[model samples]
Target chain A: MRLVRQLFTVTGLILLSAGYAHADDIKLVNQAFKEVAVVNAKGEKEFKLVEPGTVVPKDEILYITTFANTGDQPATDIVITNPLPNNSRYKAGSAFGAGTEISYSVDGGKSYGTPETLKVSGSAGQTRAAGPDDYTHIRWVYTGELAPGAESTVTFRTIIK
Target chain B: MAGRGYKQILSRLAAVLLLGYMDSSFALGTAANTVINNTAVVDYQVAGVPNAVNASVAFTIEELLDVNVVSLDAANVSVVSPSSGRQLTFLLTNTGNGSEQFLLSVDTALAGDNFDPVPASARIWIDANGDNTLDTLNDILYNGTNGPVLDGSTPGNDAVAVFVLADIPAGRTAGELANVSLIATSVIADAAGEVNNVGAEITAGGDGGVDANIGVSGAQSSAIGTFEVVNSGVSIAKSVLVFDTQGGQDPHPGAVLRYTLQVTVSGASSIDNLVITDSVPANTTYVANSIVLDGVSQTDAGDAPGVDFSDFNISNANTVTVDLSQGGNITVVPPASFTIGFEVTID
Candidate 1:
């Protein structure tokens, strides 16, 4: 009776794989922010790390999100989405995530497209190519499987208003 | 012989008194509207019965009216057109003998001045507290319904503050002089009415009374205080501050930038109807909801009632329009300035 139960379970797994395969476990994500500061060290302007919550006018902040696969099984085709913080503008070409395909949203994440295809309304009421500041959301699509106990981080920079 | 002796003694005593009185009379003649008097009595001891006689002398001082006025511009008030808060200050002194009051008036519609249309509804103010400072909180507003009183107890010791309040007409250029005449008429006793003394000069009366008529009856003094509408207009300056991985303020692709606009009102005046507008530059995107005014974060879409995001607009052009003169708030008074900032990224 136990052997028969084992066979039935194996058959169920095969059937599920033939149809729509789902990830065995969901990935856990952590988010935080940091400001970018330019410090004058010995008369040279150098980039410095500034803790979050101390941003000033004309300062830049970096939004970082870390994802970890804590489940016993691998996670596949993982995707992450983050909204642009208020009172800030996304830095052009600042999004970075290794081994991930990137896309942006300007319509409150309802739709997304590449930078070349995205467009926003200009002051003249004419639709023009969207700039970095128009981006409302950013998404990263992981092409490779996230092995168990694996971790990855995605980051983007924004300027404080 | 007794009659002769009495006559001699009386004559000698009278001569000594007369000489002393003459010296003092000449010396005390300096002041006007003054009175000096002397009395003398003679008695002879030979009659032991004490027969006595008395004499008196009196002098009435003449009256002199001199009105002197000096501009007290110590506050460094800035005169902006179409504004009523501009203060033109002056000091009025009695300079004459006896306590008296003066009627105050302003003439904005004077010739040889730069104002196209003279200031309107001119009013007067007084330093009632005697702090020697012109502050609305502490000073008194004198509308000239009653003239100002200068105390004569201490001649030249009492100086009355005269502040002229008027509305500068709009479109007056900078450096244009608004010549205003401050007519101060002495309040004379038994004057025909509250004397404005406009058509004629007042004279101090041989007698005394308190009416706005200066001259012989009292003595009216006229002084001219000018209100020059300073042209220090509002100025708007714009600059871009940027941050990129490559460094420097020069914006790069994917670099964020802060656009700053500084508005300043220089000179000695205040201005109104201050409106500022700016459209996001090309090749850049405005960060959504990124508008800051005077160090406070503001909303991008909201209604106006207080310090909300409604003070600005992100309409066509991703533009920003700020009205400093919001229903008379934020009037650009001279020596005042404000700053506004927004964010964008280079495409």
Candidate 2:
């Protein structure tokens, strides 16, 4: 009886693998950059994002994560989560993601909510509304399905502590 | 389907019940050579199948070479001419993100001063005893080669007490001022001439194998302390001998009060225009012909032409004046003193 049950389990795993062989459909890339001011031919100063070579405290960094559907099938219920880097604080109102609902987690990545709904425990043991500095992780849930070969990007900013 | 759904709910509830501890903030920002790693995870369903992928990026924090030098003295330090071992206190802090060694220097030939400190007399010392005082016996003298190494990781170990000692030059008059500066520079290799280079980087020059970058302080700082010359060596001792009727020392009517002003001068240089003036006490009458200089009688009139320099009621009413300089013709040298005595009767 045990040999028959193991044989059936092996068959079920093979069938599951064959049915969803293209499970590696999504490709993600993350990069960090900093802004620098440059003067144009018109003598006007403009800010531009450049590779960060030497970042120091109080320097703002832009983090961009790009995702693409590499398979033939559409990807549904796409979610991306990122924890704030160490020695950094999230820049308020800097998260941007089109066609997706953005939420934050003050309790690591366990649960998420809007900034107004999220709460954190203060050093004095009191509960208070979570601010951008209190956010530990950020989550974005794509409402629309991502078609095959479709690509999108999410970006946020943080300041080095 | 119901059993799977129940398991998913239970896992979600367990996750919600979990607590996460927050990291404490770093006062000096991130430490040097710290690698900050960030990763993002993507989860999606393709054809009812679950998949997950993550991407990561990391960078190392460079060292910030910043230093602060401030004079801890509240005001100008008072010193007598020809004095040695006078010290000025200062605080040297490594306001950076990495441990740093500083090379200390002192400059005494500053502008806008009446005199410069004695050449080669300026020295630096570390307050090894933490007493905030310059103890020649306990404090470690800072030789040109041995600089202080301060740890910038914590506030308690980031600052050090410094003392600058110099000798006051002779012949500096009272109210004369001199300025000295204590300079501290980062001892990182090739850190010279990089002051105010806020973003300049030195590869692999910091502690813990980190790159060193010049901060807003330019890796160097200096603070100036002033030394004001004061005539503290000149002193005066006053005494009074009261003689009442029947030679009794009592304060009664018709009693004679003899006041003596003993003037002494000591230092490297003589003082000119040494004048002594005293007013008659209240409810008393000045005794005529009672003025004496160095135990010699002086007339009530202001004598001249090689005569005495003591007189009664000359400058002000009931006031006795004695010109120790003999009308600016002499300089009262050091190790010398003179006595002026005058009498007043009780009214």
Query: Top lDDT: which candidate number?
Result: 2
Model 2 TM-score is 0.69
Candidate 1 on B227-272: residue-level lDDT in tens? 6666567788998888985776666798998999998888664577
TM, every model: 0.38, 0.69
Q: Among all windows of ten consecutive residues in candidate 2 chain B, which has the lowest summed lDDT? A: B13-22
Instruction: Summarize candidate 2's per-residue lDDT along A1-161 as a digit string, tens digits.
Output: 35643554455456567765254578998988776667989998655667767776656777878888988778999999999999889977777776889999998888999999998887789998899989999999999999988888777778787
Name the top TM-score candidate.
Answer: 2
Q: What is the per-residue lDDT of model 2 for residues B230-344, given as tens digits with 9 covering 90 to 100?
A: 7765688999999998799998999999998888886545688888889889999989988888889988788475788877788556788888888888888775888888899
User: What Cα-based lDDT does every candidate model obtain?
Assistant: 0.58, 0.81
TM-score of chain B of 2: 0.61
The per-residue C-alpha lDDT of model 1 at residue B165 equals 71
